[model samples]
Structures are given as C-alpha cells and as structure tokens.
Target: MVRVPGAKVALSTASCYPETCTTAFEMAADLGFDGVEVMVWTDPVSQDPDALRALSDRFAMPILAIHAPCLLLTQRVWTTDPWTKLQRAREAAEKLAAPTVVVHPPFRWQREYAREFVTGLARMQDESGVVFAVENMFPWRARGREVAAYLPHWDLLELDVPATTLDLSHTAVSGSDALAVCDALGDRLAHVHLADGAGSNKDEHLVPGRGSQPCAEVLERLAARGYAGCVVLEINTRRAVNRDEREADLAEGLAFARFNLAAEAAT
Candidate 1:
C-alpha cells in the first residue's frame, strides 16, 4: 500500500443518490471529506460552474476534480460532439478550480473520436491548466461473448495519456491486479477512484474492502509513495435500503481510507 500523507480524501458526487448534485457535496462535507469530485451529467447544477462553486463555498469543500459527461447516460449533457463535451468539462474544471477532469475512452463505434483521442488529449492538456485523466472502463460481456467496449481497453499503460484515473472496480472487472496496475501506472497516475468489486464481470462499485481488490494495500501504497493526487471514494450505494445505509457505506469507505492511510504513516 502506498502512503500519501496530507493527501485529500474526496467523495465523487456520483457516489451518492442521483437526486441532486448538491446532495453529494453536503454529504461529503458532513462526513469530513476534504474535497469532492463533481461528476457532470443530467443535473443542471452540475453543468453550471456558478452553481457548483456556490455549493463548494457553502460546504467549504473544494471541487477536487470534474468527471466529464462521457457515459451513455450523460451523452446529452454538454453536446453530442465528444470533443465539445471534453472542452466543456475543461471549462468547468477551470471555473471550479478543479485540477483534474476524468473521462472515459470513446466507444468502439466512435471510430473517428477514438482515432484522435490520444493526440487530442495531448492538445487539450497542452492548452489547459487542467489534467485530462482518462478513466479505465471494463469490457461488456454477454452469453460467453466478450465485447471490446472501450477504445483503450481497461488497462491504460500503453496509452500515451499524460495522466489516468485508476478505478479499482474497473480493474476488478478487468481481472487485473491492483498493485501491478498501480506499479505500471507510475508517474502517469494522477487520480484514483477508490471502490471495490467482487471480481465479477459486473461493474460492482462495492465499498472498499468489500470486494477482492486490495483496497487497503492500494491506499497504503499511495501513502508510502507520497502520492499527491486526490483519493475519491467512488463507491455505489444504490442498493442501500435507505439514507442510513448509504451513509453507513460511504462512512465505511472513508474510514477504510483513513485507517490505511494512518497505518502507512505508522509503518
């Protein structure tokens, strides 16, 4: 496990119920999170920098990162043009004072976008102060048939991306070792989506330590290596019975991060 002393532990806004984006900021602040990653999607406020900045001020939690509206559900957030969406996300990041923007690779069908992804990403990073951290996505499998869902696959070591958002749940679905993947990432690792999965093809965003991923060790490793990136708890609590259950799950994930972080310091 890597020890990242003084690193901020943030909560991805998408980790909470999709009712309202501000709900996430409120919960995160109440739970003692140092910052938050705003996942921009259909929520009107998420697309508005002013609104987000207001919430950040109200909660006193900084917007650590901005997740671009790249998922299928968010296809209509900014614009149909993938490049435009990225640009909008970058603009939002700059407005919110977020340092990183998390994005998913293009789908296989978007041949044109995929073709220019690497080069375009480079240009964006060169043009902006923010880092475009491409996130790892799992493959789609059905009836023993596997489909290459993402342009760069779930592992990003080969991509010429300057930075990456290492998602533990995606690695679990990809059947990749967390430590090995982190090792390969090295300096390119700019952010982390802290979650867990049961090594199933399903993208189960389980709480840290609830699945097969070495969640604690990974945290410790980050601490030990003096990682400066923000650690965002991106777990799924949609299956929770109620608000209390969701709060409990999120609390547990935060506690896990804190404990491992402290343990690393001790060692």
Candidate 2:
C-alpha cells in the first residue's frame, strides 16, 4: 500500500482552470501536484472535453476527477436539454474519462429537492460508472462542522465507498470534530478540501498554517489511520489580484501544504 501521512499532494483544477483547462493542466504539471481534480463549469473549458483529457494525460497526472457543475444562482443539477449542466458534466467525464465527480449538496433546498437530487445523483453514478462523491453543505449553518453534527443521516446517504469527499476546513468552520468526522468517514473518503479556519468556528479558507486549526494534529490522525486520498487546497479565489497572482500563490501554498504532510509522516 502507499505510505500514510504523506500523500501525493493534489490540485483542484478550479484553482487554475477558471478560464481554460489546458492552463489548469499545464500549471498543475509545472507546479508539481501529484494529480488534479477538475471543475467542469459550463464555460468554454468544459465545452471541449477531449482536449481537457488529452492535456491531463499528457501531463502524466496519475489521478483525474471532475467536480460537477453546481450553479449557485439557480442551484440546478441536471436536465434533459443540451445545456443541461449535469448532462454536460457526465458527457465531460465520459469524454475526459474522469474517475469521479464531486458534488455539493444544496444548502437550502426543500427536503423534496434534496431527495430528488440524491436519487438523481445515484442514478447518474450508476449509469456513468463514475463515483459520485457528495460534499456536505449546511442544510443550515453558520459554518461546516454543523453538517458533521447532523452527520448520521448524511453518512448513511454516502455509505457507498469512494462517494464522499471530506472538506476538513469547511467542517472545521462548522465547529465540528475533525477527528470524529475523519473517524466516521473511514474509507469512504476519496478527497479532502484543505484550508485553515479560525478555530472550529469561522469558514474562512485561510492558507494552511495561517490560522488556528491544529493542522499537525489532523495530519497525524490521518497518518495514524492510513487514509489515502487527495488533499485539495482551497484558498479563496476572490482575494487573488489577478490570474497570475492566483497561480503563484496557489502553487506556493500547495507546496507548503505538501511539505507539512511530509513532516507529519516523519514525526
């Protein structure tokens, strides 16, 4: 088995692909993340899936996954039409052949909508033969760990293996138990979104080590448990002065995160 504590650092192509996927792959390759998890928004980048695939492969990144398009304004998941975002997501996955799709649960939808959404997601996962890793959102929260506090039901919903991505910082923001969340999750975790929060409270995606979280403790827990999954660094994009600045900051920040992971392993 692969080593624990020190995982192959991963990059979310969303960090690089805000405009085009080629740039995402190129930057990821040049910057040295072990692999990439991409977001296929309805923009021009996802419009051409094959190209994205070719680029990712060319970079020789071992793992490839996609984040399903989640429209924040309307919060639509799928439909029958051509512009049907979910349909396009599946098409993009098939064409680019990503292993999984990361999904975000709607925060304030009617209970019925969440049900239909989960059912629909399950069907899509079956048909596409791709893993659907659902992420937790506050059904109602000041932050992410609140989702963990309400976790037993959501855990059942995501019992399927490899269909859950643990966003530690988000959960921390929810004032949830990081170790408890990790414990309950076990092997179902396929990915992790990393950032630091001001304690177990605020949902700020501060650069790792720049906040109050016990990063070393969390890493130690994962190391001891032998959890092998992607750790995605999610610094807020809004603060980036420009694309180039974003790229530079993200590259440096991810490198630091990975280095700490190595340090965790050694300790």
Best by TM-score: 1
Q: List the candidate 1 regions with Cα displacement exceeding 4 Å.
A: 1-4, 262-267
The total of clashing pairs for model 2 equals 3
TM-score of each: 0.95, 0.74
Residue 251 in model 2: shift from native, Å?
2.8
- Candidate 1: count of backbone clashes, pairs at least 3 residues apart or interchain: 12
Task: Report how far off residue 212 is in candidate 2 (Å).
Answer: 2.9
lDDT of 2: 0.62
lDDT of 1 by residue, 7-100 (tens): 7899998899654789898999889999999998788988899999999999999999999999878877889899999999999999889999
In model 1, the worst 10-residue window by lDDT is 258-267
lDDT: which candidate is best?
A: 1
lDDT of 1 at 171: 90
Q: Among all windows of ten consecutive residues in candidate 2, which has the lowest summed lDDT?
A: 143-152
Clashing pairs in 2: 143-174, 144-174, 145-174
Q: How far is 94's C-alpha from truth in model 2 (Å)?
A: 3.6
